[model samples]
Target: MVEGDPAAPYTDATRARLEVAFAAYELADLARAAVPIGEHELSPDGTGRSAGATLADAAHVLGAARRFFEAAAVFERMAGADWELVGDTLGVSARAARDRFAVAEVCFREGANGPRGETSWWRAHLAEQPLEAARDLDDWVLRHRDGDGDLGTTPVSGGLVRRVNTGG
Candidate 1:
Protein backbone atom coordinates (compact mmCIF):
# COMPACT_ATOMS: atom_id res chain seq x y z
CA MET A 1 0.00 0.00 0.00
CA VAL A 2 1.30 3.38 -0.95
CA GLU A 3 0.96 6.03 1.72
CA GLY A 4 0.65 9.71 0.90
CA ASP A 5 1.39 12.86 2.88
CA PRO A 6 -1.39 13.44 5.36
CA ALA A 7 -1.62 17.07 4.36
CA ALA A 8 -1.92 16.19 0.66
CA PRO A 9 -4.55 13.55 0.41
CA TYR A 10 -5.45 14.34 -3.20
CA THR A 11 -3.66 12.70 -6.09
CA ASP A 12 -1.97 14.61 -8.88
CA ALA A 13 -4.78 13.68 -11.26
CA THR A 14 -7.34 15.09 -8.87
CA ARG A 15 -5.43 18.35 -8.67
CA ALA A 16 -5.28 18.56 -12.45
CA ARG A 17 -9.02 17.99 -12.69
CA LEU A 18 -9.50 20.76 -10.14
CA GLU A 19 -7.39 23.10 -12.22
CA VAL A 20 -9.41 22.28 -15.34
CA ALA A 21 -12.64 22.88 -13.47
CA PHE A 22 -11.33 26.22 -12.21
CA ALA A 23 -10.57 27.27 -15.79
CA ALA A 24 -14.03 26.26 -16.95
CA TYR A 25 -15.49 28.29 -14.09
CA GLU A 26 -13.53 31.33 -15.20
CA LEU A 27 -14.69 30.94 -18.79
CA ALA A 28 -18.27 30.56 -17.64
CA ASP A 29 -17.92 33.75 -15.58
CA LEU A 30 -16.65 35.63 -18.65
CA ALA A 31 -19.50 34.36 -20.77
CA ARG A 32 -22.00 35.31 -18.08
CA ALA A 33 -20.64 38.84 -17.92
CA ALA A 34 -20.59 39.21 -21.70
CA VAL A 35 -24.26 38.28 -21.92
CA PRO A 36 -26.67 41.19 -21.74
CA ILE A 37 -29.85 41.46 -19.70
CA GLY A 38 -32.43 41.12 -22.48
CA GLU A 39 -33.06 38.27 -24.90
CA HIS A 40 -30.49 37.98 -27.64
CA GLU A 41 -29.20 35.39 -30.07
CA LEU A 42 -26.64 33.08 -28.49
CA SER A 43 -24.53 33.20 -31.63
CA PRO A 44 -24.02 35.83 -34.27
CA ASP A 45 -24.38 33.03 -36.78
CA GLY A 46 -27.95 31.72 -37.17
CA THR A 47 -26.93 28.06 -36.72
CA GLY A 48 -26.41 28.16 -32.95
CA ARG A 49 -28.38 28.31 -29.73
CA SER A 50 -31.74 30.09 -29.50
CA ALA A 51 -32.36 33.29 -27.59
CA GLY A 52 -34.57 33.95 -24.51
CA ALA A 53 -31.71 33.58 -22.06
CA THR A 54 -32.24 35.73 -18.96
CA LEU A 55 -29.83 37.36 -16.55
CA ALA A 56 -31.16 35.00 -13.87
CA ASP A 57 -29.77 32.03 -15.78
CA ALA A 58 -26.41 33.73 -16.06
CA ALA A 59 -26.54 34.57 -12.38
CA HIS A 60 -27.33 30.97 -11.46
CA VAL A 61 -24.52 29.63 -13.60
CA LEU A 62 -22.10 32.18 -12.15
CA GLY A 63 -23.14 31.16 -8.65
CA ALA A 64 -22.49 27.51 -9.49
CA ALA A 65 -19.11 28.44 -10.96
CA ARG A 66 -18.23 30.29 -7.80
CA ARG A 67 -19.14 27.25 -5.72
CA PHE A 68 -17.09 24.99 -7.98
CA PHE A 69 -14.09 27.30 -7.63
CA GLU A 70 -14.54 27.34 -3.88
CA ALA A 71 -14.65 23.54 -3.78
CA ALA A 72 -11.49 23.27 -5.88
CA ALA A 73 -9.81 25.82 -3.64
CA VAL A 74 -10.77 23.78 -0.58
CA PHE A 75 -9.13 20.71 -2.10
CA GLU A 76 -6.09 22.78 -3.04
CA ARG A 77 -5.80 24.08 0.51
CA MET A 78 -6.08 20.54 1.87
CA ALA A 79 -3.30 19.46 -0.45
CA GLY A 80 -0.56 20.96 1.75
CA ALA A 81 -0.63 24.57 0.55
CA ASP A 82 1.30 26.81 2.94
CA TRP A 83 -0.12 29.95 4.52
CA GLU A 84 0.72 31.89 1.35
CA LEU A 85 -1.41 29.63 -0.82
CA VAL A 86 -4.13 29.70 1.79
CA GLY A 87 -4.11 33.50 1.78
CA ASP A 88 -4.28 33.61 -2.03
CA THR A 89 -7.27 31.32 -2.11
CA LEU A 90 -8.92 33.40 0.60
CA GLY A 91 -8.44 36.60 -1.51
CA VAL A 92 -6.24 38.29 1.11
CA SER A 93 -3.10 40.14 0.01
CA ALA A 94 -0.07 37.87 0.49
CA ARG A 95 2.14 40.41 2.24
CA ALA A 96 -0.59 41.51 4.68
CA ALA A 97 -1.56 37.96 5.55
CA ARG A 98 2.06 36.85 5.81
CA ASP A 99 2.95 39.77 8.04
CA ARG A 100 -0.03 39.00 10.29
CA PHE A 101 1.00 35.36 10.44
CA ALA A 102 4.58 36.42 11.19
CA VAL A 103 3.47 37.33 14.68
CA ALA A 104 2.26 33.79 15.21
CA GLU A 105 5.54 32.55 13.78
CA VAL A 106 7.37 34.40 16.48
CA CYS A 107 5.14 32.88 19.14
CA PHE A 108 5.26 29.41 17.61
CA ARG A 109 7.46 26.95 19.39
CA GLU A 110 9.01 24.12 17.39
CA GLY A 111 7.85 20.58 18.27
CA ALA A 112 4.67 22.01 19.78
CA ASN A 113 1.56 20.47 18.25
CA GLY A 114 -0.52 23.67 18.70
CA PRO A 115 -0.74 26.86 20.64
CA ARG A 116 0.24 26.59 24.30
CA GLY A 117 -2.71 28.45 25.81
CA GLU A 118 -6.22 29.30 24.64
CA THR A 119 -5.96 32.95 25.64
CA SER A 120 -2.54 33.29 24.06
CA TRP A 121 -3.78 31.66 20.85
CA TRP A 122 -6.82 33.92 20.74
CA ARG A 123 -4.71 36.99 21.36
CA ALA A 124 -2.26 36.10 18.62
CA HIS A 125 -4.92 34.99 16.15
CA LEU A 126 -7.32 37.91 16.63
CA ALA A 127 -4.78 40.69 16.83
CA GLU A 128 -5.36 43.46 14.28
CA GLN A 129 -3.01 46.21 13.14
CA PRO A 130 -3.63 49.12 10.82
CA LEU A 131 -1.68 48.96 7.59
CA GLU A 132 -0.94 52.70 7.77
CA ALA A 133 -1.37 55.13 10.61
CA ALA A 134 -3.21 58.30 9.66
CA ARG A 135 -1.24 60.83 11.62
CA ASP A 136 -3.02 63.80 10.05
CA LEU A 137 -6.58 63.33 8.85
CA ASP A 138 -6.40 66.58 6.92
CA ASP A 139 -3.30 65.48 5.12
CA TRP A 140 -4.82 62.10 4.34
CA VAL A 141 -8.00 63.75 3.00
CA LEU A 142 -6.07 66.25 0.90
CA ARG A 143 -3.89 63.47 -0.49
CA HIS A 144 -6.97 61.47 -1.44
CA ARG A 145 -9.08 64.40 -2.62
CA ASP A 146 -9.49 64.94 -6.34
CA GLY A 147 -8.58 68.12 -8.27
CA ASP A 148 -12.21 69.26 -8.01
CA GLY A 149 -12.11 68.64 -4.22
CA ASP A 150 -15.12 66.37 -4.41
CA LEU A 151 -14.86 63.34 -2.16
CA GLY A 152 -18.53 62.75 -3.00
CA THR A 153 -17.85 61.57 -6.55
CA THR A 154 -17.75 57.89 -5.68
CA PRO A 155 -20.28 56.04 -3.60
CA VAL A 156 -19.44 53.69 -0.77
CA SER A 157 -21.21 50.36 -0.46
CA GLY A 158 -20.65 47.17 1.53
CA GLY A 159 -17.72 48.76 3.34
CA LEU A 160 -15.87 49.03 0.03
CA VAL A 161 -15.28 52.58 -1.05
CA ARG A 162 -14.02 53.21 -4.54
CA ARG A 163 -10.57 54.77 -4.85
CA VAL A 164 -10.79 58.51 -5.25
CA ASN A 165 -8.89 60.37 -7.95
CA THR A 166 -5.82 61.38 -5.94
CA GLY A 167 -4.32 63.89 -8.38
CA GLY A 168 -0.73 62.90 -7.82
Candidate 2:
Protein backbone atom coordinates (compact mmCIF):
# COMPACT_ATOMS: atom_id res chain seq x y z
CA MET A 1 0.00 0.00 0.00
CA VAL A 2 3.00 2.28 0.44
CA GLU A 3 3.67 3.42 -3.12
CA GLY A 4 7.06 4.87 -4.00
CA ASP A 5 10.30 4.06 -5.71
CA PRO A 6 11.49 0.77 -4.27
CA ALA A 7 15.09 1.97 -4.36
CA ALA A 8 14.34 5.26 -2.67
CA PRO A 9 15.83 5.52 0.76
CA TYR A 10 13.32 5.83 3.61
CA THR A 11 13.81 6.96 7.14
CA ASP A 12 13.61 4.25 9.79
CA ALA A 13 10.26 5.60 11.01
CA THR A 14 8.70 5.40 7.56
CA ARG A 15 10.08 1.91 7.04
CA ALA A 16 8.81 0.72 10.39
CA ARG A 17 5.32 2.15 9.86
CA LEU A 18 5.12 0.61 6.39
CA GLU A 19 6.13 -2.76 7.78
CA VAL A 20 3.43 -2.50 10.45
CA ALA A 21 0.80 -1.56 7.88
CA PHE A 22 1.76 -4.51 5.68
CA ALA A 23 1.64 -6.87 8.62
CA ALA A 24 -1.81 -5.55 9.57
CA TYR A 25 -3.04 -6.15 6.04
CA GLU A 26 -1.71 -9.70 6.15
CA LEU A 27 -3.39 -10.29 9.48
CA ALA A 28 -6.71 -9.06 8.12
CA ASP A 29 -6.43 -11.37 5.15
CA LEU A 30 -5.62 -14.33 7.38
CA ALA A 31 -8.56 -13.59 9.66
CA ARG A 32 -10.89 -13.51 6.69
CA ALA A 33 -9.48 -16.77 5.35
CA ALA A 34 -9.76 -18.46 8.72
CA VAL A 35 -13.52 -18.06 8.67
CA PRO A 36 -14.66 -18.65 5.15
CA ILE A 37 -18.33 -18.29 4.40
CA GLY A 38 -20.47 -21.31 5.42
CA GLU A 39 -17.44 -22.87 7.09
CA HIS A 40 -17.45 -21.06 10.43
CA GLU A 41 -20.97 -21.77 11.59
CA LEU A 42 -21.26 -23.49 14.93
CA SER A 43 -24.26 -25.57 15.89
CA PRO A 44 -25.80 -25.42 19.33
CA ASP A 45 -24.32 -28.86 20.06
CA GLY A 46 -20.97 -28.07 18.44
CA THR A 47 -21.23 -31.19 16.31
CA GLY A 48 -20.38 -29.66 12.90
CA ARG A 49 -16.68 -29.05 13.39
CA SER A 50 -13.90 -31.61 13.66
CA ALA A 51 -11.01 -31.24 16.15
CA GLY A 52 -8.54 -30.82 13.29
CA ALA A 53 -10.52 -27.96 11.79
CA THR A 54 -10.72 -26.18 15.12
CA LEU A 55 -7.02 -26.68 15.79
CA ALA A 56 -6.06 -25.41 12.34
CA ASP A 57 -8.14 -22.25 12.79
CA ALA A 58 -6.67 -21.64 16.21
CA ALA A 59 -3.11 -22.04 14.93
CA HIS A 60 -3.69 -19.73 12.00
CA VAL A 61 -5.12 -16.99 14.17
CA LEU A 62 -2.35 -17.37 16.72
CA GLY A 63 0.36 -17.07 14.10
CA ALA A 64 -1.23 -13.97 12.63
CA ALA A 65 -1.53 -12.39 16.08
CA ARG A 66 2.15 -13.03 16.80
CA ARG A 67 3.23 -11.40 13.54
CA PHE A 68 1.02 -8.37 14.22
CA PHE A 69 2.45 -7.98 17.71
CA GLU A 70 6.03 -8.19 16.48
CA ALA A 71 5.41 -5.63 13.78
CA ALA A 72 3.67 -3.34 16.26
CA ALA A 73 6.56 -3.60 18.69
CA VAL A 74 9.04 -2.68 15.99
CA PHE A 75 6.96 0.30 14.92
CA GLU A 76 6.60 1.52 18.47
CA ARG A 77 10.36 1.43 18.96
CA MET A 78 11.02 3.28 15.73
CA ALA A 79 8.41 5.87 16.68
CA GLY A 80 10.11 6.46 20.02
CA ALA A 81 7.03 5.49 22.03
CA ASP A 82 7.69 5.27 25.73
CA TRP A 83 7.11 1.97 27.50
CA GLU A 84 4.32 3.44 29.58
CA LEU A 85 2.48 4.59 26.48
CA VAL A 86 2.98 1.21 24.86
CA GLY A 87 1.76 -0.51 28.01
CA ASP A 88 -1.38 1.63 28.18
CA THR A 89 -2.12 0.84 24.56
CA LEU A 90 -1.67 -2.88 25.19
CA GLY A 91 -3.45 -2.91 28.57
CA VAL A 92 -0.34 -4.13 30.38
CA SER A 93 2.15 -2.82 32.89
CA ALA A 94 4.99 -0.69 31.55
CA ARG A 95 7.63 -3.18 32.60
CA ALA A 96 5.65 -6.10 31.19
CA ALA A 97 5.19 -4.45 27.81
CA ARG A 98 8.83 -3.50 27.57
CA ASP A 99 9.91 -7.01 28.50
CA ARG A 100 7.65 -8.57 25.89
CA PHE A 101 8.44 -6.22 23.02
CA ALA A 102 12.18 -5.73 23.53
CA VAL A 103 13.24 -8.78 21.56
CA ALA A 104 11.04 -7.90 18.60
CA GLU A 105 12.47 -4.37 18.50
CA VAL A 106 16.02 -5.66 18.60
CA CYS A 107 15.38 -8.33 15.97
CA PHE A 108 13.79 -5.83 13.59
CA ARG A 109 16.76 -3.50 13.88
CA GLU A 110 19.31 -6.30 13.65
CA GLY A 111 17.65 -7.82 10.58
CA ALA A 112 17.71 -4.49 8.76
CA ASN A 113 20.45 -4.60 6.11
CA GLY A 114 20.66 -1.04 4.89
CA PRO A 115 23.36 0.60 2.78
CA ARG A 116 24.21 2.64 5.84
CA GLY A 117 26.51 1.31 8.58
CA GLU A 118 24.28 2.20 11.55
CA THR A 119 22.61 -1.19 11.87
CA SER A 120 25.54 -3.32 10.74
CA TRP A 121 26.78 -3.52 14.29
CA TRP A 122 23.56 -5.19 15.40
CA ARG A 123 24.01 -8.11 13.05
CA ALA A 124 27.45 -8.91 14.44
CA HIS A 125 26.41 -8.47 18.03
CA LEU A 126 23.10 -10.31 17.77
CA ALA A 127 24.74 -13.31 16.14
CA GLU A 128 27.10 -13.72 19.09
CA GLN A 129 24.73 -12.74 21.90
CA PRO A 130 21.75 -14.44 23.43
CA LEU A 131 18.30 -13.08 22.65
CA GLU A 132 18.14 -11.75 26.20
CA ALA A 133 20.91 -9.39 25.19
CA ALA A 134 18.37 -7.44 23.19
CA ARG A 135 17.05 -5.72 26.30
CA ASP A 136 20.48 -4.32 26.93
CA LEU A 137 20.60 -2.76 23.46
CA ASP A 138 17.22 -1.06 23.61
CA ASP A 139 17.05 2.21 21.65
CA TRP A 140 20.70 1.82 20.64
CA VAL A 141 19.79 3.30 17.27
CA LEU A 142 17.97 6.52 17.89
CA ARG A 143 14.86 6.68 15.70
CA HIS A 144 14.93 10.29 14.61
CA ARG A 145 16.01 12.25 11.54
CA ASP A 146 19.08 13.52 13.35
CA GLY A 147 19.85 10.09 14.80
CA ASP A 148 21.86 8.96 11.75
CA GLY A 149 24.58 11.38 10.78
CA ASP A 150 25.42 12.41 7.23
CA LEU A 151 27.54 9.98 5.20
CA GLY A 152 31.02 11.34 4.56
CA THR A 153 34.71 10.92 5.20
CA THR A 154 35.82 11.04 8.81
CA PRO A 155 39.08 10.55 10.64
CA VAL A 156 39.51 7.20 12.33
CA SER A 157 42.67 6.52 14.32
CA GLY A 158 45.15 8.81 12.54
CA GLY A 159 43.85 8.77 8.97
CA LEU A 160 40.70 9.94 7.22
CA VAL A 161 38.33 7.11 6.29
CA ARG A 162 35.19 7.13 4.22
CA ARG A 163 32.18 6.00 6.26
CA VAL A 164 28.84 7.05 7.68
CA ASN A 165 29.51 10.16 9.71
CA THR A 166 28.94 9.72 13.42
CA GLY A 167 28.10 13.25 14.52
CA GLY A 168 30.73 13.38 17.21
Candidate 3:
Protein backbone atom coordinates (compact mmCIF):
# COMPACT_ATOMS: atom_id res chain seq x y z
CA MET A 1 0.00 0.00 0.00
CA VAL A 2 1.02 3.63 -0.50
CA GLU A 3 1.97 5.64 2.60
CA GLY A 4 -1.28 7.51 2.65
CA ASP A 5 -4.18 7.01 0.25
CA PRO A 6 -3.70 4.04 -2.03
CA ALA A 7 -5.64 5.60 -4.90
CA ALA A 8 -4.23 9.10 -4.59
CA PRO A 9 -1.23 8.76 -6.86
CA TYR A 10 -3.10 7.01 -9.62
CA THR A 11 -6.08 9.35 -9.43
CA ASP A 12 -4.04 12.53 -9.41
CA ALA A 13 -2.08 11.40 -12.44
CA THR A 14 -5.19 10.11 -14.20
CA ARG A 15 -6.88 13.49 -14.63
CA ALA A 16 -3.95 15.12 -16.39
CA ARG A 17 -3.16 12.02 -18.44
CA LEU A 18 -6.81 11.70 -19.45
CA GLU A 19 -6.79 15.24 -20.77
CA VAL A 20 -3.68 14.63 -22.82
CA ALA A 21 -4.99 11.30 -24.02
CA PHE A 22 -8.31 12.74 -25.12
CA ALA A 23 -6.55 15.56 -26.93
CA ALA A 24 -4.28 13.09 -28.69
CA TYR A 25 -7.26 10.95 -29.68
CA GLU A 26 -9.12 13.93 -31.02
CA LEU A 27 -6.14 15.14 -33.01
CA ALA A 28 -5.69 11.71 -34.55
CA ASP A 29 -9.36 11.47 -35.41
CA LEU A 30 -9.32 14.88 -37.06
CA ALA A 31 -6.24 13.99 -39.04
CA ARG A 32 -7.88 10.81 -40.25
CA ALA A 33 -10.87 12.86 -41.35
CA ALA A 34 -8.60 15.01 -43.54
CA VAL A 35 -9.07 18.06 -41.33
CA PRO A 36 -6.30 20.50 -41.99
CA ILE A 37 -4.08 21.12 -38.98
CA GLY A 38 -3.28 24.81 -38.85
CA GLU A 39 0.33 25.39 -37.97
CA HIS A 40 0.99 27.19 -34.72
CA GLU A 41 3.63 27.29 -32.01
CA LEU A 42 1.38 26.02 -29.23
CA SER A 43 2.98 26.31 -25.82
CA PRO A 44 1.33 26.02 -22.42
CA ASP A 45 0.96 29.19 -20.32
CA GLY A 46 4.68 29.96 -20.02
CA THR A 47 6.34 26.70 -20.98
CA GLY A 48 9.25 27.41 -23.27
CA ARG A 49 8.91 24.08 -25.02
CA SER A 50 6.66 23.83 -28.04
CA ALA A 51 4.15 20.97 -28.14
CA GLY A 52 5.32 19.38 -31.38
CA ALA A 53 8.30 20.48 -33.42
CA THR A 54 8.43 17.82 -36.10
CA LEU A 55 6.46 15.01 -37.75
CA ALA A 56 8.32 12.35 -35.82
CA ASP A 57 7.77 14.20 -32.56
CA ALA A 58 4.06 14.45 -33.23
CA ALA A 59 3.92 10.74 -34.00
CA HIS A 60 5.71 9.93 -30.77
CA VAL A 61 3.52 12.27 -28.78
CA LEU A 62 0.35 10.67 -30.11
CA GLY A 63 1.62 7.17 -29.48
CA ALA A 64 2.77 7.97 -25.97
CA ALA A 65 -0.40 9.89 -25.14
CA ARG A 66 -2.58 7.01 -26.34
CA ARG A 67 -0.76 4.55 -24.11
CA PHE A 68 -1.48 6.67 -21.05
CA PHE A 69 -5.12 6.74 -22.07
CA GLU A 70 -5.15 2.98 -22.49
CA ALA A 71 -3.45 2.46 -19.15
CA ALA A 72 -5.84 4.79 -17.39
CA ALA A 73 -8.76 2.99 -18.93
CA VAL A 74 -7.37 -0.28 -17.68
CA PHE A 75 -7.01 1.12 -14.19
CA GLU A 76 -10.56 2.36 -14.30
CA ARG A 77 -11.67 -1.08 -15.36
CA MET A 78 -9.85 -2.64 -12.45
CA ALA A 79 -11.78 -0.46 -10.06
CA GLY A 80 -14.93 -2.64 -10.07
CA ALA A 81 -15.69 -2.47 -13.77
CA ASP A 82 -16.69 -5.99 -14.73
CA TRP A 83 -14.74 -7.88 -17.34
CA GLU A 84 -17.81 -8.08 -19.58
CA LEU A 85 -18.27 -4.33 -19.43
CA VAL A 86 -14.59 -3.82 -20.08
CA GLY A 87 -14.74 -6.26 -22.93
CA ASP A 88 -17.63 -4.38 -24.52
CA THR A 89 -15.91 -1.04 -24.09
CA LEU A 90 -12.56 -2.24 -25.37
CA GLY A 91 -14.00 -4.61 -27.98
CA VAL A 92 -12.31 -7.67 -26.55
CA SER A 93 -13.31 -10.83 -24.78
CA ALA A 94 -13.84 -10.78 -21.01
CA ARG A 95 -10.74 -12.87 -20.50
CA ALA A 96 -8.77 -10.62 -22.81
CA ALA A 97 -9.99 -7.59 -20.90
CA ARG A 98 -8.74 -9.09 -17.66
CA ASP A 99 -5.50 -10.07 -19.33
CA ARG A 100 -5.03 -6.54 -20.64
CA PHE A 101 -5.53 -5.10 -17.16
CA ALA A 102 -3.18 -7.66 -15.71
CA VAL A 103 -0.57 -6.74 -18.29
CA ALA A 104 -1.22 -3.09 -17.62
CA GLU A 105 -0.78 -3.54 -13.89
CA VAL A 106 2.67 -5.03 -14.45
CA CYS A 107 3.57 -2.37 -16.99
CA PHE A 108 2.28 0.37 -14.75
CA ARG A 109 4.12 -0.84 -11.69
CA GLU A 110 7.15 -2.99 -12.42
CA GLY A 111 10.20 -1.57 -14.26
CA ALA A 112 13.54 0.17 -13.73
CA ASN A 113 12.02 3.54 -14.56
CA GLY A 114 12.01 5.78 -11.50
CA PRO A 115 8.33 6.36 -12.02
CA ARG A 116 5.62 6.55 -14.69
CA GLY A 117 7.06 9.46 -16.67
CA GLU A 118 10.57 8.08 -16.63
CA THR A 119 9.46 4.98 -18.49
CA SER A 120 8.70 7.06 -21.56
CA TRP A 121 12.37 7.88 -22.00
CA TRP A 122 13.37 4.26 -22.59
CA ARG A 123 10.15 2.79 -24.01
CA ALA A 124 11.81 1.62 -27.19
CA HIS A 125 14.60 -0.22 -25.43
CA LEU A 126 12.60 -1.89 -22.68
CA ALA A 127 10.46 -4.94 -23.05
CA GLU A 128 7.68 -5.46 -20.48
CA GLN A 129 6.20 -8.87 -19.71
CA PRO A 130 2.59 -9.90 -19.41
CA LEU A 131 1.32 -9.57 -15.84
CA GLU A 132 0.23 -13.17 -15.36
CA ALA A 133 3.73 -14.32 -16.26
CA ALA A 134 5.53 -11.38 -14.74
CA ARG A 135 7.58 -11.21 -11.56
CA ASP A 136 5.82 -11.06 -8.22
CA LEU A 137 4.60 -7.60 -7.23
CA ASP A 138 6.52 -7.55 -3.97
CA ASP A 139 9.74 -8.39 -5.75
CA TRP A 140 9.17 -5.68 -8.34
CA VAL A 141 8.30 -3.03 -5.77
CA LEU A 142 11.33 -3.92 -3.68
CA ARG A 143 13.47 -3.51 -6.78
CA HIS A 144 12.15 -0.04 -7.64
CA ARG A 145 12.29 2.86 -5.20
CA ASP A 146 12.26 6.62 -5.43
CA GLY A 147 15.16 8.95 -4.68
CA ASP A 148 14.08 9.33 -1.04
CA GLY A 149 14.12 5.54 -0.74
CA ASP A 150 10.34 5.66 -0.79
CA LEU A 151 8.60 3.52 -3.36
CA GLY A 152 5.59 4.94 -5.16
CA THR A 153 2.77 2.42 -5.19
CA THR A 154 -0.79 1.79 -6.25
CA PRO A 155 -3.15 -0.59 -4.45
CA VAL A 156 -3.45 -4.01 -6.00
CA SER A 157 -5.71 -6.94 -5.16
CA GLY A 158 -4.81 -10.50 -4.26
CA GLY A 159 -1.04 -10.50 -3.80
CA LEU A 160 1.57 -9.75 -1.19
CA VAL A 161 0.48 -6.43 0.26
CA ARG A 162 3.16 -4.37 1.98
CA ARG A 163 2.45 -1.87 4.74
CA VAL A 164 4.37 1.32 4.06
CA ASN A 165 6.17 2.95 6.95
CA THR A 166 4.36 6.22 7.51
CA GLY A 167 6.97 7.65 9.91
CA GLY A 168 4.29 9.38 11.85
Best by lDDT: 2
Best by TM-score: 2
Model 1 lDDT-worst window of ten: 126-135
Backbone clashes (count) for model 1? 0
**Candidates sorted by TM-score, descending order?**
2, 3, 1
Given candidate 2, what's the lDDT at residue 92?
Answer: 96
Residue-by-residue lDDT tens digits, candidate 1, 35-145: 663344445565336444455566667755654444344444434566677678668876755554443333332212122232322222212211111112223344445
Q: Order the candidates by lDDT, highest first — what do you get? A: 2, 3, 1
**What's the CA error at residue 158 for candidate 1, in Å?**
44
In model 3, which runs have C-alpha deviations exceeding 4 angstroms?
1-54, 109-168
lDDT of 3 by residue, 1-168 (tens): 223444222332332233233334445544454334334543545442544445655576576555655656555654557778888887889888777656555554453332334444332222232122113332434444336354434212122222344557
Relative to the true structure, candidate 1 reaches a TM of 0.29
TM-scores of the models, in the given order? 0.29, 0.53, 0.35
Q: For candidate 1, what is the lDDT?
A: 0.40
Q: Is candidate 2 or candidate 3 better by lDDT?
A: 2
Evaluate model 2: give its TM-score.
0.53
Model 2 lDDT tens row, 32-137: 6766635456666766555577677778777767767777777887878999999999899999998887776766676653322234343344334422223232
